[model samples]
Target: MTRSTRGGAPVAPKRVTPRAQWTRGSPGGTAGTPHPTASRRRWRRTVIARRAADHVCETFGADGIQGVCGHPEIEVALAEFARYTGDRKYLEQARLFIERRGHRTLADIEFGRQYFQDETPLRETDVMSGHAVRALYLAAGGVDVAVETGDDELLSALRTQMANTIGRRTYLTGGMGAHHEGESFGLDYELPPDRAYSETCAGVGSVMVNFRLLLATGESRYADAIERTLYNVVAGSPGEEGTSFFYTNTLHQRVPGSTPSPDEQSPRAASSLRAPWFDVSCCPTNVARTFASLGAYVATSSADGLQLHQFVSGEVKAELAAGHVSVAIETRYPDEGTVRVTVAETVADEWELAIRVPGWARSGGLLVVGDSEPETVAPGMARVRRRFAVGDVVELRLDPAPRFTYPDPRVDAVQGSVAVEAGPLVLCVESVDLPDGAGVNELRVDPAVAPRVADGRTVVTGRMARFEPTDWPYDPEAEDVDETAAFEFALTPYHRRANRGPATMRVWMPCA
Candidate 1:
């Protein structure tokens, strides 16, 4: 029967199709596991890189030049974004905001100027200036279009400014910048043995600037300085866990109760364990970024070949004009001293692998496998030349010995004290291992004798080591005759201390 509907025709109820719901096991749902496709992973990485760049730019750019503390980080983030996204827009924005402030040679940009308004430029150049230089150098490459078009006078000025800074600010210890409170910059050449403000960030920033300089000018000294900083200063900043940090690092150690706070204490004479984080909290992030971008720092290329500066276990892929050449270094370096470099791809051209053998690695020098006999790579530099092939392995071994470092007696902190070091890590004595009531202050070790690992820790024992003090003034020449009492003390790695409790800790103790 034909029934008349709305307009004289019979109409039926329309069936509705449910929206495609994304369920756990439904089609295109991924089923609790992510899609194992390259596109998906690449997209995820792109998003993260973009977000990181945007956060840095937005957070720091809100105040213009006032955001110099985060300037270098932001620049790096932007460069990374531009690299990943293949977008010149991000690079342009970074160049406009970060590099547009002043004409080349930004040496006039004074310390703490980011927070101040009235353009009272500071002539007193410091580590902060080095950081700014690094940021500018990072941006200089990505947005070459802007740099080339923008003020040529400014770029020339900046080059001159950086050259002047490099000449004036360097210390005999190879450390740069100085600050007593923030452990930033000290007066030029005020490199005191008792009070040296070799802030970790300053050291790192120096290396960063020098690295860029190396890229700009194919000089080896910049790479040399970087290697030195990595071994002595930067390596010492991170704790054994590779987490904790020290704002200031010194070669000296002082008595436990003499210093106010750890950061304020001078590291020149003697030093103690590194703290987890500081009030400034810049060192931690600095370390994180450095470690994250470590691959970029390892191998640098020139017209000739590649320069391998630092050695660590990792894989490095360099896209050369010939083809893609991959080098994988595998070893427990600094600790075990062996680094194996394996070539993963074949190349027609002969390439040079310049490895840096740390100055401390004397006597038992570097050893390269696949080549007959252990080659004696110099303490400063090791140049290995060979025609590369797939699966070619180069093995290098440096000296791994526990050395005892003694501070200058003139330094008040460790007048008659010495510290033990394995690789770059300073060893210390925790109060937990010391006898009850007899604190670390009463501890003494004979410099002539070596401390060995006993009961899973370094220990020293000797006669004439008593808890009680002698009568009258403490004479430096007069030797104690009381030789009956002797006690043993155990020591742990400096970075491992403070994890137990608030106990007395000392990196250097009086020599018996």
Candidate 2:
């Protein structure tokens, strides 16, 4: 499906063309316009995005072409444009595009209608399929439309779809899209680590949905997903100082390939190392957009209180029902789970302050507000509701002990494998970190001993086993193994892998 874009040979709205991401620099729910002192470029967002959305509405809107675009981004952008321009027509256009999806109204692809989520209606679909990024963008758009139109039914369906997708179709590192064939989601539990396409744009799309859902439901699970994806997938894609980038983030690298040149455009799907650029440079732009708008994802404000989602060090100010308040957050977050939040300015009336305890910290967490005694908190929102003065403080300490994680039995690809995690970071053993003669594919780890963080490195017990070579590899009796050697190797965070040099790395280690 294609729409006439302000008068051109009708163009399909997808990432193929380098369209301006007007929704960047702000999350959702910005009403009216930017401040009067906002820059010319900032003010231009209202004109440029609104005009593009207006063209879309006039062409494919309800009273116009009764068709939808192949890609889903326009709908979500329209919702934001409606907010920026204070125009309800753009909101209606968004609602129309969302309701028109999943009806097989568009031409099918070689990968099938599910590739674009055209197999079922938006309100009836219960699971996410098709291209991982497209499905996520559609869900985000649906949630935005539902929020604006107060469509509870659509919101409920989207919630179910996201829960289903996160529970089954997602990777340990919070990545989606298992197949490189179409950058689409595989069947449930079909995640193969080495072959994962885990496109960087998909991670960005996941954060988009997660942030909206976080605000809509006030759920900690959404924030937890955001943390995992940001640490592992989004932050992992780019190299030092953002000079190079990985288009696809695979969980396991089976072979040590050649290093990428500083000037070359990488093969998008199979870049062995981070390349300087790519022809389809959507991942870089998506990453840049997310980074520029990070403050919105970090926290949100309400009429009565303020909530901190990600523990990044920052400051927040919001206008409450009683009066205005400002808070400053200081933290060393995932590295050391301690966060100190101070009320810089406050209203005399009572109000609430909330900080999130990530779902992964299932063991222990400590919270202290003002002069109160230390209180224990679990995996949810920890709140402090009381009269506040300047310099009032609230503190949170979370458990970040190194732990071993096992996959669900239904996931055959990694049924007997074990992985290590500390806080939100997934740890993997790289070939470069192994002892002599030990290969990533040839070693087996023992999970009986817990992982320990020493000198900022996660060390685990493992052994290298050598098998005798034979002309006919397969045999009925498999007893040609040589003596094995036991040793320990330091596990590096998955994001830091491939940065040292060309090396093979695997997140899922087979247990001995």
Candidate 3:
């Protein structure tokens, strides 16, 4: 299972060790020479990681290292090295790993036969299940193998599984992993806001899978998923401008707990209050890496031109089939719906610029090319092909109206309640913003009223019906309890909750 390098040391390929070197220098490095010190440092880490991987492979054989589906982890590493170095041997090893999966090699594990996704083979599996992170990482490896081997059937199967994951298993924040038991995916429409185990690591893994999918299909939907998760779950992971961290993200927290000390571990599965660090602290490191490489996700190049997926204010320069195009994007996106893209430099006379229209942009969207007439753009993406000049601007306006969303009826947890969302942010009602003695659970939203920005925070002014509870369950036959005067309350984004202090928060509210 282990590969021998120079001196018979079992390690990952030497080209894989160049990862840190590539990261330190330009990713567009020449294949001939690599920087000396960075290469050494990266090789050290690669050996350490490969030794661990080798130990697992030797222990588990075809069952894989971490689990039955874990062979893809090593396969991805080898495939990446192969792509960078053009080594066919590494590709062969990667192909071997792919072929060995889906035989239930680790079925005897206490969790069950399907626990490690060994129940079904990659090409035959239609629905994404098992640990959310593992499933995503495996799919990414599958994408690499499919692209390298020119396996059209495997590529199509991976796309179908990606669609199934995005359409049915994803959260409003683009977070995955609904069950805390195994940090795994649950049944379709089984999403529960309160009991969500949307691990931060899983969210990062989702972005990785989506990025690979984007490269494979040249589609904008994958970028959409990346953008959503980046803004909501991943952005929410770092607390107070990247000081603390949240390992798990939940849309709602109905009860408040005492804030734990910086040295203390959180008693709850997911903390309402962000901690400075945790014992198992992969999230903080993952968030750091994602932020460092964010520019890579904002724009992608094609034979025609460049496509912009995220609207963050940044500079995008990409070489296209026509020539190189550089554009400056200015926008207060997520907070505001306006994006202005100005062409700073251009080598191509005529090319295409594609901007993604978020699925939640209910009022559709508007795109204006230069001084031309404004044209409405539907969801998916808006493509503008034109001859460009320096200083020419493209304006896109997306609807920012606050909208209330309801879950599928099958998700019994929030069946009779509604959640509010403005742009990509999911809104929650926190006790700190409410009157004393009034908890978030006692509040209700008036769907007729629109939410507006108040004091730099999104606020929905709604009435809460007051009912006096006397027993465990009110008898239908008995007289109804007297109602007190209705009071008004406000709602804020779920990510902003507990920032001021530990407080109860609720995303789903009853209709008054």
Candidate 4:
């Protein structure tokens, strides 16, 4: 039987086939033993799942595919696949999954409906709760379906949830899922540093949702969130060479040991160093795909004109509503905030060139066009619409000054501490950056000292004071000798931790 896709898109009928096979790893001995590792098992399960999905696609045709609607990630993927392939079957399946959330289709045995996001329908849910990755994935799917089907209510609901999440649950480093207990989001303003369950997968999902929202609404705010997450959380999750990964990204590590524990999956358990692979291994895979597909997030074409969301050294060609536009973006962005967009080809006579001015650049950076007066851009996006010719140059000078950031007063952790941020990167002090005896907790940052760029990283000069624990728990009479010392410490990007071997690290530093 043949099935037609939604939106009147043409598709050839696919037939079901059996192609499952057993495979072995690299040979070791004469006959290698079966690898019983969790990584191997996980890979095997993924292969099986893909085959099963193919079988489902062929057996049910397009529109005939239907289930009880569990596993929000799979549902989201189905929606995205439908959109990409112009298949209505998967889109309908995605909608069914999203719409039936509150009906309790899945068995919520121990954790209940909240864990599976079944207690409340997305449209009615006020705040995004439960599993952080799952919630973000579900919302992203909603955005995909809503944009395709012209459903404004669903889009609005998701926007509300996003706004609430950004205002309350999100960390300064753009990490998500505040509570370590369920690996889920906690109440409003419940961000905790040591107890954070900000999984790397969640950071990837945050960018996914923000990108979709930006596509659906053409909002600059979503792009801002995308930039922050990409730099601080997503970039920081992986090691420098991309071999090791941190499953749970923490804001602060108070202890000295730098070893990966067997129970590293627990958010409370701090793995000071990144591991080659984790028992779960979701973050590594997610990071791989995210980095590979980063070009799609850099720019997009709207009815008004072309838009550049991210700054990267690449060429973007798009057929916009105005006409065909081609431009080359050259910059060492995130390292420095100067992007030069040279118009390689512009077919249209006039079209708006919208560029995002990051939220952190509050000083209203300078935007200069060819032979035009330098203009200041507000926090959102700066646009210039005029007759354009070939070789037109647009220069955007963004403020890359390092600034101190403080968390909300309601957040109990890091109350008196401050985090340093330069461009999109969140700076952290590693033990390797400090003196031999000066611990991370003992080093204090003098806010008055200006951070300087050195050795491709930011360095903060500050005063350090070593506090010795006395035998008496409470002693009003304590001799205060000279324990203060001056030190210049280098701050590494949060994402690049564990790259220089395992060491203690702290994002928030106490003021001296």
RMSD of each: 17.5, 8.9, 8.8, 10.5
What's the lDDT for residue 291 in model 1? 70
For each candidate in turn, the TM-score is 0.59, 0.91, 0.85, 0.83
lDDT of 3 by residue, 1-512 (tens): 11111112111111101133332222332233334655666555654544554454455444445344442466677677766555455566666667667887664565554556677888998878887777777888888888889898998999899898878888877889888877789988778888888888888888888887787776667877887787778877877755677888877777786665887766436566788767777787888888888877777776656677778898888766677678999999888899999999886467766777787886678888778787887776677767878998988899776678877677777777888888887777888888765677667666676666666766665554555554656566334434345555666766666687788787788765
Where is the poorest 10-residue window by lDDT in model 2?
10-19
Task: Show pairs that collide, candidate 3.
Answer: none
Clash pairs, candidate 2, are: none
* True-structure Cα RMSD, model 3: 8.8
Over 1-512, each residue of candidate 1 has an lDDT whose tens digit, in order, gives 11111112211111111122221222321122223443556555555655655555555454544434334345445554554455544565566444444233233344443311112222222222433333233333322322333544433444454455445444333455444543344333344433555667766776766665555544445555676566656666776666556676543334343322544633431334555445566777877777776666676654434556667787766655566677788977656778888888747887655555665554536556576666666554455566777887777777655667766444454567777766544577766776664556556676666766665566666433543454655764335444446666677665455555456666666777
- Model 1 lowest lDDT segment of ten: 1-10
Residue-level lDDT for 472 in candidate 3: 54
Better of 1 and 3 by TM-score: 3
Ranking by TM-score: 2, 3, 4, 1
Report how far off residue 33 is in candidate 4 (Å): 44
Candidate with top lDDT is: 2
Please write out the lDDT profile of model 2 over residues 1-512, one tens digit for every residue. Answer: 11110121211111111123233233332333455566668666665655566678789877799878787898888887776555778889889888888788989879998888788888998889998999999999999999888999999999899999999999999999999988899999999999999999999999999888877777768889999999999999998766889889888888888887767777798688888888788998899999887777777666767777888887787777798788898988888889999999999888877778888988658887767787887777777778888999999988787899999999999988999999999988889998763569877888898898778788999877667666676864345555366677899888887888788899999987
State the lDDT of candidate 4 residue by residue for 358-384, as single tens digits. Answer: 888877678888777877777666777
